[model samples]
Target: MRLMLVEDDDHVAAALTAVLSRHGFAVTHCRSGAEALQAMLPDDRAPFDVVLLDLGLPDTDGFEVCGRIRKVSTTPVIMVTARSDVRSRIHGLNLGADDYVVKPYDTGELLARIHAVARRTTPGTPDPADPVPGSDVLRLGAVTVELTTRQVNVGGAAVPLTRKEFDLLALLAGRPGVVFRREQIISEVWRTSWEGTGRTLEVHVASLRAKLRTPALIETVRGVGYRLVPPAAA
Candidate 1:
């Protein structure tokens, strides 16, 4: 895979580059946000498969770089930073980052996250074990979910949802009243395990509720997971 490592610390970047190289990745290390952005431009060079971005850079903030990258390209970006707070994670996701890996992470886990995001963005890659919906459209009272287009609407008005938010909502709407365990949801939607991803799932659910304008649409099952409360049931 062609991967971009945007980290300013030479020691950190060199160690990570060596690890990535051993894994058969063509690693391009950029020490600053500007350099990373310049390299990301569409050129004769092979397009990057994934980006591992560090939040602290010499030239600019990582979040700004992520937003800029989104405006120019659709390549998957995974923010590797020390900010483990839920707010930072949510902000990164909101800015179009494909994943957020807190610092002091397991190298194996980081590799898995890289492949997961790359796989999701690859052309013709199927969603993780999504059930075959009877129809392309799924309707739950006032909300309408178009599975094929990945679009959602409420009361005939369009509602924009982040990619993860849509996936979470679709999973729940797929089986209304069927409580999906947290592990199951994470595995199916994010294609990752439960550890370190629970908070992300929570953020997605909260975003979905807010964007859908139906706070009661998704119900939390204490000590379990969550379920979709059909509008009629709500």
Candidate 2:
């Protein structure tokens, strides 16, 4: 796998880079969010399969940086945070992060998460759309999500959603404000393991929030999971 690591800590970056490279992965190290952004652009020279990002960057909040990155790329991102709080994990996931690892984490565990994400996103594995809106357009908040073409619109502006992100949105919007459990969403959105892809739930929710004009509509039910509460009804 090709990995882009955005970390300001020189020792951690170097040690992790060497470890991943030794395991036959291409590693690109960036010291700040700006460097990471430049590497992700079309002219970044190297193609990255995934990103290992540190949340405590000197330049910007990692979550804010992730929100910006999700506007264009679907290359999976795994957040590296110092805190192990659930809210922080949820926030990272909500900001389009694929997975997360707290500081002093085991290298093997990080590699395992990367492999799991990589496996699910294998190239040419056809993405399946939502069963309900597979042929129709969906309206949620200010966004018009086209199922047939996989496009979204908010505030008269075009929005882009990845295949998985769109499917998740369609499922949640099917019953607006109905609190769908984490496992239930996994079954509906992805016909895969609940635990293996639970993090995907957070990623798609984050992506949808960023795309939708009224982000507050996607309500987090605290200990439960996510719910789609349309603004007009809220």
Candidate 3:
């Protein structure tokens, strides 16, 4: 994967670049938010697949940089910061960050998150070599989920969902009426275990229900998990 890593600390950047390179990632190291933003500008070069951003920068705050990036590109941005507070994480995500990774993190977990975000941003297509079953667009009553474009619609009205919210909805919609365990949902959607990430799943579910304007669409199975009931079925 091609990545733009924005971190002011030379030593830290160098270490991360080396590690990511060893894992077959093409990484461009930027010393500040300005440098990172400049690199992200339209150019002949192909756009980076993902951005690893640090909140602390010399020229600008990482949150501001994230907002700027979102205006130009939909490339997944993962906030790599030392801030571990939940508020910081929510703030970064609200600013359009695809994922938030607190410092002192497991390298394996970070790698997993990078792949997860990439999967969400990258469109999936049926292979010509091997026959793959399943349609790209999932229709459930009036709600339509165009998997290839990541667009959600309800009764012909577009529903704007965050990356995580869309992921969650798509997961449940994939198997309507099936109760997906909370742990399973977190693993599949958030790419994290059901530990500190449970609250995130809850928040996304609530948001999806609200945005879809169908509280009954996603039925909460008491003492279990959640299930998707098509509007028609409901």
Candidate 4:
């Protein structure tokens, strides 16, 4: 598979090139963010299956690079970074990145992640409970959801959502206009390890409305959690 390798360091790039090449992948390595952007938008460069992006770049930060790419592309991205913070990884994931790998990683694990990330790029398989024409997949106007893959698309364009965002949408979309209490959603969707406040659910809901391109679908019941119906696309 053709993969875009965007990293600023020479040694890391070289090592990745050799390792990835040995795995039968055609790697197009770019050192600078400018070069990476240019390569992605090249008139002749066909879309690569996946991007292995480093967070640190000489020309520009990879986070900004990723944000720019999301404005036009849905090609899967697996971010490679030296930052060990979970929040940083979560931020990248929120910006539409499919996965995150830290520095000093294993080549085999990276390749495995790439392969797993590839399978998720296209999710059409049906689950037992979904309705026909993707009823098993959730449908709310412009939003078409793949419950199995946890991917959400608005107006046929994929939306960059974190795992929690996807879960919140799935729960609400399952029952249109059902007012779930914040605690209920937290208990049901999050199960355990919910470190944020009741307001955190609101934060996620607010974020969903902002990114969803529609504010009417998820309605607030005043002291209730949230509800979902077909998005008012018009």
Candidate 5:
């Protein structure tokens, strides 16, 4: 993958670039926010796959740069910085960052995150195993999932759902009795392998049960994962 590293510190950038290059990534080191932005412009070269941004840029704040980049391109941006406060994380996500990694992160985890963001952003053919393929709809007892339309309804009534919530439900509902490992769900849904994603996955599952008004619909296997128990009619 083609990656852009935006950091003002030469040593830090050099270290990261070397690591990324060794992993088969074409790394472009940008010393300032302006330089990063200029490189992102439409050019003869193929566009970058992902960007690793540092908040302590020489010319501009990384958050501002992220916002500006969003206005110009759809390339995924992952904020790699020393800011670890809750507010900073929220603010970076609010500015359209695909992921946030605090300093002192494991290189292996960073590589996984980079691949996740790139895969999520890139357009590709639909999985052949996806349940809702032709008509783009799947029905489980009283619950209904419309994949193409991105809608969900329960017993003829519409149930509002965020994007991730719907995705979680659809994944489980596709194979009612099969248990889905937490890691598999996260990788397929969030497209990331970060250990911290487990909490987010749990929250989404709880929200799905509540919204569907079926607490027993999704059963949690002890020390395993989760599975959808199809209703009687289904």
Candidate 6:
């Protein structure tokens, strides 16, 4: 995966770039907000898979950079900073950060989060529950999920879904009326055993419901997990 590392500190950026490079990620190191923006221009033919942003920068605040990037690209942004306050985390997320990682985080966890976000944002990668060759489409009521093309439509109109959202929907849609455990969804979709991922799952589910405008399409089985309710059943 190609990753943009926006950190003003040379030593820190170098260390992270090396680590991520060893993990098979092509890292583009930027020392300031301006440099990061410049690298993200349309002229820069190489597209980035994810962005690792630091709150401290020489030219402008990281939040401002994040907001600006959101205006131009839907590339997932993960804020890597020392600001551990809840407000800071909330504010970063509000500014379009997909995930916030505090400084002094475990390297393993960081790698996991990187893979997690990339899985949700990269559509080219095949989904685990890849549909059969001839049966690449699943329809649940007004919702239609084209597995091969990674397209979702509702009521004959297209519905945009984040990578994670599509994975979750596809997983459940594969087995309509069967409740998938929360842990199973996290492991399958997020590719993590981290329990904290449960909250992220809930957030994705809520967002999916709002976007699809078919809340009844995904039925939540309290204490268990969720299932797709076919239109006939609904």
Task: Give the candidate number with the greatest TM-score.
Answer: 6
lDDT of each: 0.85, 0.75, 0.82, 0.76, 0.84, 0.84
Tens-digit lDDT string for candidate 1 (1-234)? 689999999999999897677555789999999999999888998899999999999999999999999999999999999999999999999999999999999776787687689878867432333434356888888899999999899999999988888888888887677666687688788887889999998888888888888899999978657888877879
For candidate 4, report its TM-score. Answer: 0.52
Error of 1 at 155 (Å): 66
For 12-125, candidate 4 gives per-residue lDDT tens digits of: 889888767644468999998888888888576667878999988987889988988877787788899999798999999999899999988866467657767876784542
Give each prediction's root-mean-square deviation over alpha carbons: 14.4, 17.1, 14.0, 16.6, 12.0, 13.5
Can you give the TM-score per candidate against the true fold?
A: 0.54, 0.52, 0.54, 0.52, 0.54, 0.55
Tens-digit per-residue lDDT, 1-234, candidate 5: 578999999998898887676555789999999999999999999898889999999788999999999999989999999999999999999999999999999776687688778768866423312564465788888888888788999999999999899888888877666666676678778988738998998899999989999889998877657888878723
Query: Which TM-score value belongs to model 3?
Result: 0.54
User: Candidate 1: misplaced stretches above 4 Å?
Assistant: 124-234
For each of the candidates, give the backbone clash count: 0, 0, 0, 3, 0, 1
lDDT of 6 at 73: 95
Better of 2 and 4 by lDDT: 4
lDDT-sorted candidate list, best first:
1, 6, 5, 3, 4, 2
- For model 6, the stretches where C-alpha displacement exceeds 4 angstroms are 126-234
Record all residue pairs in model 1 with backbone atoms less than 3 Å apart, i.e. clashing. none
Lowest summed lDDT window (length 10), candidate 4: 125-134
Clashes of 4: 3
Off by over 4 Å in 3: 124-234
Model 3: lowest-lDDT 10 consecutive positions: 124-133
Q: Best candidate, lDDT-wise?
A: 1
Error in Å for residue 19 of model 2: 0.4
Give the C-alpha miss distance for residue 167 in model 2, angstroms: 35
